[model samples]
Target chain A: MASVNRPNKQQNHPLDDLIRKDRIPHIWCPGCGIGTIFASCLTAIKECVATGKNGFDLDKFVMVSGIGCSGRAAGYVKLDSFHTTHGRAIPFATGLKLANRDLNVIVFSGDGDLFAIGGNHFIHAARRNINITVICVNNLNYGMTGGQVAATTPYNAKTTTTPAGNAENPFSLPLLAYASGATYVARWTMLHTRDLTVSINEALSKKGFSFIEVLSPCPVNYGRRNKEKPLETLKLYQEKSIIKNGADPSELDIDMEKGIILGKFVDIDKPTHSEKYDKLYRIE
Target chain B: MTENTTESRVLTGEHFMTGDIACAEGALAAGCRFFGGYPITPATEIAEQISLRLPRVGGTFIQMEDEIAALTSVLGASWAGLKSMTATSGPGFSLMMEAIGLGLCTETPCVIVNVQRAGPSTGLPTQGAQADMMQARWGSHGDYEIIVLAPSSPQEIFYQTITAFNLSETFRLPVIIMTDEIVGHMSEKVIIPEAGKIETVNRLRPKGRKDRFKLFEPDPNGVALMPAAGDGYKIHVTGLTHDEKGYPVMTVEAQAEMMARLTGKIRNNIDRIIQTEELFLDDAEIVFISYGVSSRTCLEAMAMARSKGIRAGFLRLITIWPFPDDQIRALAKRVKALITVEINLGQIHREVKRCAEGKAPAYLVGHPGGTVIPPERVLAMAEEVL
Candidate 1:
């Protein structure tokens, strides 16, 4: 109450230059973790741009996202962003990157967007080792559609569509990425911001399909039905997640009762799709 | 391997080529450097020929997982400042409808070639049919105008494909080349002009301050100058109803404005977009309206009707969309009757009847589309109408 009538001041965020200021006061709910994950992505991009490592040009950074709550990330970013049709972001980004090899394309989408309807594109892109960074925000449910059961919804989790508790098992994203031949695969939670940012930065420097699964909270949709608050989710992430670097991808499934294996699971070199195309098709 | 030269790129001489191969060469000559496609019957040859030729001419060809990916990739490549194309049949064309709507909403310039096959869900895959004509007009679930060119022969497909790329660039939307299985596989003499002799129109690039540029801001022609991804425009493009700045604005007024920009471009420029070929319509009493492979049959029918003293005129629709309403209305005012000939069962006939507005009696001479409608059936329809 001391300075309730004090003059309002305009404060700028550090990542304001990278954001579309007019589009803010974003659609993300209060306890949602997408904002933090998005911040980490911008931070990774900033770091890559500053270091000029791996030919990361700010002008050449294009953000592509599919339909979901997180798909709106493409609209919020000031970079050349495309909010493509649902489940087609990877193929769209594939076209953009393959058309102009100079551009650095990153697809930022949600778990429902990346793994559910877009699963085929995800696996094929990883198989081809396309040079792109895909950061999937795993929010465990279809938060945009009011907490419906998603492909990544935890087993026995109560959702709008699965109010009796889900009977389906969730996808182990890192395991899928590894099995699909992703050159770089990692998993981290929003609570692990430093590790997530570093992993994203490392993925950006790599030259093949790099996938990083970021477990984010959809407290309003997921936590309320699961009888867990945002703080409780964060606590579980802190206490139950084990930072096991280079762990076997098969052992990286998320189990709230057990432990979530978090860290880089796969990192190997292979010729990217473009490199192979050039080698086979382009003769000087 | 053929030498990649300006000559090789244009293939600047007359050659006997299939419609699919000629279409691919036309794309190459029109500066289409990226093709994203999936193999479907009757259209697979386009993909095959492009895959073999595109790489040699410094182009990229990707066989996508499905038609959805194929068309979406084409849209993405187009936004990256490449003239992109995709070829598909009825099944694949159906799969591409949603992406076509996306392409319209985002004002992306690309070419979609639909080599028609009979279909109501895989009806006839290997045979030729013109059943998808109506689908081509109203395939995508939206209130947007589209440019569709119906090329009847291998040579016509070659020239029309180049025109398709030009029109797409000029209007900044996906232009469709609606050739059927008959024309797609038919081999004929296609004249390939030298690269310099061919006129290719490129999308206008934004000039002046990059920061001040709005992505969806239309010029006098209702088309905005486009900038590529790495051009530092920092543009945001979405399928949502967007403002001139390409930012999604969820309001009725925003929807109205965006719709105007999307639909106005084609409506205002209909004169330039609509192309038709007329034969002996000056003083004829009866007229026959047709397009694509069916137009070839209509021509033969008109000649037969003329021999029988029926005074039948032929009107071939080269540009099917925008419907040539003005020409139809005027012809309806003068003619006694209009006979619509197509392989499909009375699709364009309905459009002709609507435009005729009961001024002239419109009858359809159509088949169920397993095979082409013979000229005798069309001539019989004309005599019965008379």
Candidate 2:
């Protein structure tokens, strides 16, 4: 039998320079929204590098991620990156930023890593207004650990640990960020890649602590158990999400029934941790 | 940039200082520009002292939310091209185990000072104990080797802190300064040498082409050259078992290779890492092995035994880990018996016994560690062994 010869075509990914080419075929599953969110993050980094905004350069960026499926982003990114222990990406990034104020430290991790075990560090980092950007992928469950319930899991959601439906209310991450004194807070679904990229780019340029919540779908672990396919989840996000800039953070909780509020809720300039530290301690 | 001229980074000449404060000054003198720690008893003085001194030296001191964060932040700062450190007691040291493993795996250079307090859990925060000696050896879960230095006095601790930083940088792993609450709290005369007299070691930086660099590839010295975060190396550091390129490789072969590098660095360089002080061992019939504050008592007991016509020799371990097996083995063959004195209930005694290989019987003059072991008890034990 003769094999048919297909047209041979080779193309370079647009973000090839930013991605670790050898680490391709990433651990992210098919139809997983994390890949989309990661692409958006890289796109923002690419834009920032092209514009050289605030002296932004590829050499000056460092990515830190904690343990989870999304935490693998640090491994895939072609930056000076750190794949730290579970739930400690924020503190690690804080130290990195404080040690070298010239570097732009970005923490990319999952909700379970950022909000559950790492809640104290997250709140404290925000309270101090450390000059770092935190991009949290909220998949509503612990995807890496087999669809276990997470701190951000929606009320009455089905998970491996919450088979009888979740009885506890989930945290409103934007509200938490606002209460914790984050200078910049925003939320966007993976479907809103353009908006999310823009928000990430803005947060990178902003001084002080910036947090962005990315609503992503975990199909194999989360969607399969909830009777929602990846495409169905995207459709739900498209249909249910309402973009409300400067909306009250308290109303930004994830409730599909009440409509999901998205967009920049808080954006204000403030002295960052390094700035305050230098002001008080670096006196000549 | 503001020049640091208010206080000399190295406070030269004689000054009465606590071991905790001396450790802090040692850190400053050794180019430690970043300290991330939480205030814990017995160890809190180190943080307090560093907090006041670091700013004047144009360094940073951060009080993290917890000990876990404290250690992790120190690791972060180390990777960002700073000689970084943290200090804590028993409970805090327990919380820092996982991060210590991360530091080991990533081959990050930093110093961890554990001012030992009695503890199963919060045992005696204000009192000193040698209970953590064993914990310092195997506290972090894994197959790895560590360099630990036990200092007996404020002067020794100050010198050892500098040595700790140098060893950490040389080996590219976290070096622990295992001092106790007694030594940490007790004040004594410390002479800080001039800055020019003190030697500091910085991590080996990568040279040649940056793109062709493999972050974990060892040099001839069995240590990999490290590049800081913004050095344009674009390296990936992970807690996962990784390849020479610093990328995670989840295979047995990769695991073996990584483990060999991590452990081999210290094991191969054990002779250079181990330090001990010997007193009157030339023709002694009985030998005493001790470290940290307990060695002080052992020294006194040795003198008392000598006065009573018992030929007692004292061996003080300056470096605790890499266990000085060869030294113990040789000493075991030469001496009649080994008396191990420590505040803990026979931690290092077990190691001494193992290394002794039944050539010499090892007996422990141990205490549960609320207070220091009396010299009379140690002398009595030596007489009985004789």
The candidate scoring highest on lDDT is: 2
Tens digits of per-residue lDDT for model 1 on A94-150? 899889989999999999999988999999899989899999999999999899999
Model 1 Cα shift for residue A77 (angstroms):
0.8
Encode model 2's per-residue lDDT on B1-386: one tens digit a residue.
02123467988878788999999999999999999999999899999888878988889999999999999999999999999999999999999999999999999999999999999898988998999888888989988999999999999999999999999999999999999999999999999899999999999898789999999999887999999999999999999999999999999999999999999999999988999999999988899999999999998999899999999998899999989898989999988999999999999999999999879999999999878999999889888877
Cα shift from native, residue A211, model 2 (Å): 0.5
When summed lDDT is taken over every stretch of 10 residues in candidate 1 chain A, the lowest stretch is A4-13
RMSD of each: 2.5, 3.1
Model 1: lDDT of residue A129:
92
The C-alpha stretches of model 1 lying farther than 4 A from their native spots are A1-10, B1-7
- Clashes counted in candidate 1 amount to 0
Error of 2 at B207 (Å): 1.9
Model 1 chain B scores worst on lDDT over the 10 consecutive residues at B1-10
True contacts kept of each: 0.78, 0.79
**Candidate 2 docking category?**
high
